[model samples]
Target: MSTWTEIGDRCWVRRYDEWDLNVGLVAGSDGAVVIDTRATAEQGSELLTHIRELTDVPVRWVVNTHAHFDHVVGNSVFTDATIYLHENAAAEEDLAGTTFSVAKVIDLGDRRVELLHLGNAHTSGDTVVVVPDADVFFVGDLVEESAPPSYGEDSFPLEWPDTIDRVIGMLSDTAKVVPGHGAVVDAEFVRDQAGDIGTVANTISGLHHAGTSLADALQHTEDWPWPLEQLQDAIKRGYGALGAPRRPTLPLLGPGSSA
Candidate 1:
């Protein structure tokens, strides 16, 4: 079973597993809001069971952070709630033929949802859900807790820092942040992550501009303060696709060091 911890009177953070992902719940006098759904239908249903135990408040809103499978595939379980997302998320869902139903809301009881498109950040479809009265922000994958940020095919590394800044600006000073993965953190942690990622991106950009071959760039990244093996592989693949030189061998770090 997943673990649920209350952050406030009406807010809770659900940690499914070490790497399973986390979801948030915001309960109001009238109803409740569910942040990202789990990856599978079973996990999503598990979350609902926990919510049912806490309050009989009808679930009125279901907000998806992005279009990634882990973040949105379980949306089918929330057939009764209004499913909200960023406009780009809806568009991507349509293009990818992902099974999501906004129409199901009507059959469930005329529940309606709005898609608020903030802008491009983590992914083109990144969305932020704010509990105005509670002063809480449910940031999907945009702000992670100490773990290294994972950049996937859809991520825009160059624009992620600005996106983090925008999210921090949207929250109040006391607002609690619930990330998609890891523990709940404050605005300060968000700022630090932005700075760290920005530095890594800038370093990579500079290397590219300085005519450093992809192989050399990968080797140089071995000394990066942040964990970047995955990112290095991504860079190498990107360069290889463009017919760039092969990557050079990088020494493996001793078990714990960021190599």
Candidate 2:
């Protein structure tokens, strides 16, 4: 059986056994809004059916927390709903296939879902879904509880901590947070994770600011979470966000600076 927990009025977070990915739903009298379709069409179809069984409200909108394959890629299945995405999210190679960046507000009858692009962090188009009335937030991969936060090649490690801080600012003390993966959590869980990630980011930032060689910096991240290899990979992304190593003259995109 699929596992779900009700966090607010007609709002639920369904956790998939497959990837442990969390999908959020916020419903009102007329319709419902879905956050993060699954990785494949088959998975999306199954999820749609499960959601339909829970509520008769037709799915009116689908929001992608980010462009990651597991978090999106199911847009094709929800043909009737207006898919919402970040403007820069379309640049993601996997999501380049879909038409998005439309409809900021989804009216779930009286209750509403608002999409906010709080700068760049996880990915260029990472989107946060807010149900202010319900006091809930669906933060795609930006907040990870099932596992440690991941920093992909496209991730802005430097900006990630502040992005979490921004989400913290937007939430109420008792708000429920549905991360891209893992169990439904409270604001304090998010705060603790954000603090950890921030420490790692600040360490990398400090090393970079002090003109330490990238190699040495990677070595220094030995005590950070994740294996040395994974830590190195994440640090590299953080470094990339600052600029390419050695040749700082040819700078790439810096943290907190988005298109």
* Winner by TM-score: 2
Q: What is the per-residue lDDT of model 2 for residues 1-259, given as tens digits with 9 covering 90 to 100?
A: 6766799988899999877889998888878888999889999998898987888888988888888889887778998887777767767654533343533777777888888887678787888898888898999988888888877788888888887898999877899998988888898999899888887888888788877778888788444756566666668988877874453455678999886
Clashing residue pairs, backbone N/CA/C < 3 A, model 1: none
Sequence-dependent TM-score of model 2: 0.87
lDDT of 1 by residue, 56-98 (tens): 8898777787887787777778878877766667787662322
Best by lDDT: 2
**C-alpha RMSD of each candidate structure in angstroms:** 10.2, 8.1
Alpha carbon lDDT of each predicted model: 0.69, 0.81
TM-score, cand. 1: 0.77
- lDDT of candidate 2 at residue 15, scale 0 to 100: 91
Clashing pairs in 2: none
Candidate 1 global lDDT: 0.69
